[model samples]
Target: MAIQRILAEETVSVTEMRKHPTDFFTDHPIAILNKNQTAGYMVGKELFETMVDLIRQLQPQESFTATFQPSVTHLKAVTKGSAEFLVKANKEELGDFVE
Candidate 1:
C-alpha cells in the first residue's frame, strides 16, 4: 500500500463526522480522511468566506468599461484589456423580480 500524506494540522474520519457533524467546525481547516487517505479539507463558513476574500484581494484589479444590455437582464463589462466579465443587474434594474 502507498503512503498517504495529509497536509492539515487536524484530521477527522468520515465516521466521526457522521456521528457528530457539528463537532468538526473550527477556525482552521480540517483534513477529512477516508480509508486512511486524504479526502478534503473542511473549514468554518466564516473561515471559508475569509479565504475567498483573501484570494480576491491577491488577484490584480483591472479597469473595466461597463455596457448595459437593452433588456436589463444582463450587463457585460469589458476590461481595458481583452478580458470580459458579466455582472448581475442591480435590484432597481432587475425590477420587482428581485424584491
Candidate 2:
C-alpha cells in the first residue's frame, strides 16, 4: 500500500474513535499510542528547532547525525557554516514524498 493510504487509514480509525467516545474508552491503549504518534507528527518542526538550538548551546565536541526530511531550507538555517554539524541530504531515503 502507498504511504498516503496507510496514513489515511490510521487517520480514519482515530476519527472514528472521536466520533464514538465509548469506542475510544474501550480501546484506550490503542488510542493512547495513536495520540502519542500523532503528537510527534504535530510537533515535528518545533522539536527539530528545539533540538538544534540545544545542540548549539551545548556545543558538544562529538559528531552526531540528525536525520530529517530531505528539505534543505531548515537544515541550512540550523547548520549553515557550522563546523560542528554537517547536514547531508540522501534523496533515496526520501521515499515517494520527494518533489
Candidate 3:
C-alpha cells in the first residue's frame, strides 16, 4: 500500500478562525493537511506512523494535525518540511511529488 500527502502553506490570521490557532503563534509558515488525496487508496496504518515520525524528525518545533481516512486506512497531516523530509527519508515516496 502507498500513502500520499500534500503540503500547503497558508497565512491564517486570527480573524480567520473563531479561536486562536496556536498558543503563542507567529505569522510564519504553516502546514495544511489534506485527506481528499488519501481517499480510496490502499495505504496501511504503519505508513501513517512512519510519516508522522519522519515529519516530527524534520521539524521539531512545528505543530501537526492529522485527519484519518477510513476509506483508505491512511492518515494525512499538515506539517512543516514534509516534502524535504519525505524526499530524504524515501525518495520513491516523493516520486515527482515535490517540485
Candidate 4:
C-alpha cells in the first residue's frame, strides 16, 4: 500500500502505542506493505527502532518487548487524527513507491 494510503487507513502512533502497547501489537503486527498493498512482511529492525523511540518517550526508564500492544481506543484516536501518526523512511526504504 502506498504510505499515504496506509496513513489514511490505519492509525498507528507513538502515544497510542505507549498508552496500550499490548493491545496495539495484538491487533497490528509490525509489517511493511508494498505500494500495491498486496504483499507485506513482518518487520524487525525497522519496527524495533521506531518502537524503541516511542517507548523511551513515554517511559524513559522502562524497558519494552516486541509483544506490546495498545488499546483499541488509542488506535482509533490515532486514525482519527487526535494524535500524530508518522512513518519515516528514506528513498531506499520506500522502494515500493519508486515506480
On TM-score, the leading prediction is 1
Q: Would you list the rank order by lDDT, best first?
A: 1, 4, 3, 2
- Candidate 1 pairs with clashing backbones: none
For residue 94, model 2's alpha carbon misses the true position, in angstroms, by: 38
Return the TM-score for candidate 1, rounded to 2 decimals.
0.56
Q: In model 1, state the lDDT of residue 53.
A: 86
How do the residues 37-73 of candidate 2 rate in per-residue lDDT, one tens digit apiece?
Answer: 4421222345557767897878766866677676788
44-74: candidate 4 lDDT, tens digit per residue: 4556678768878897466555675889998
Model 3: per-residue Cα lDDT over 1-99, one tens digit each: 576543434433334322654432333333322333321222235655676689888875765666754543232333335655765776676678745
Question: For each candidate, C-alpha RMSD in Å?
Answer: 13.3, 15.3, 20.5, 20.1
Q: How many backbone clashes does candidate 1 have?
A: 0
lDDT of each: 0.73, 0.45, 0.45, 0.51
In candidate 3, which residue pairs get closer than 3 Å at backbone N, Cα or C atoms, i.e. clash? none
**What C-alpha lDDT does candidate 3 achieve relative to the native structure?**
0.45
Candidate 3, residue 42: lDDT: 22
Per-candidate TM-score against the hidden true structure: 0.56, 0.21, 0.22, 0.21
Candidate 4 residues lying further than 4 Å off, grouped into runs, are: 1-3, 7-9, 27-99
Off by over 4 Å in 2: 1-32, 35-41, 44-47, 66-99
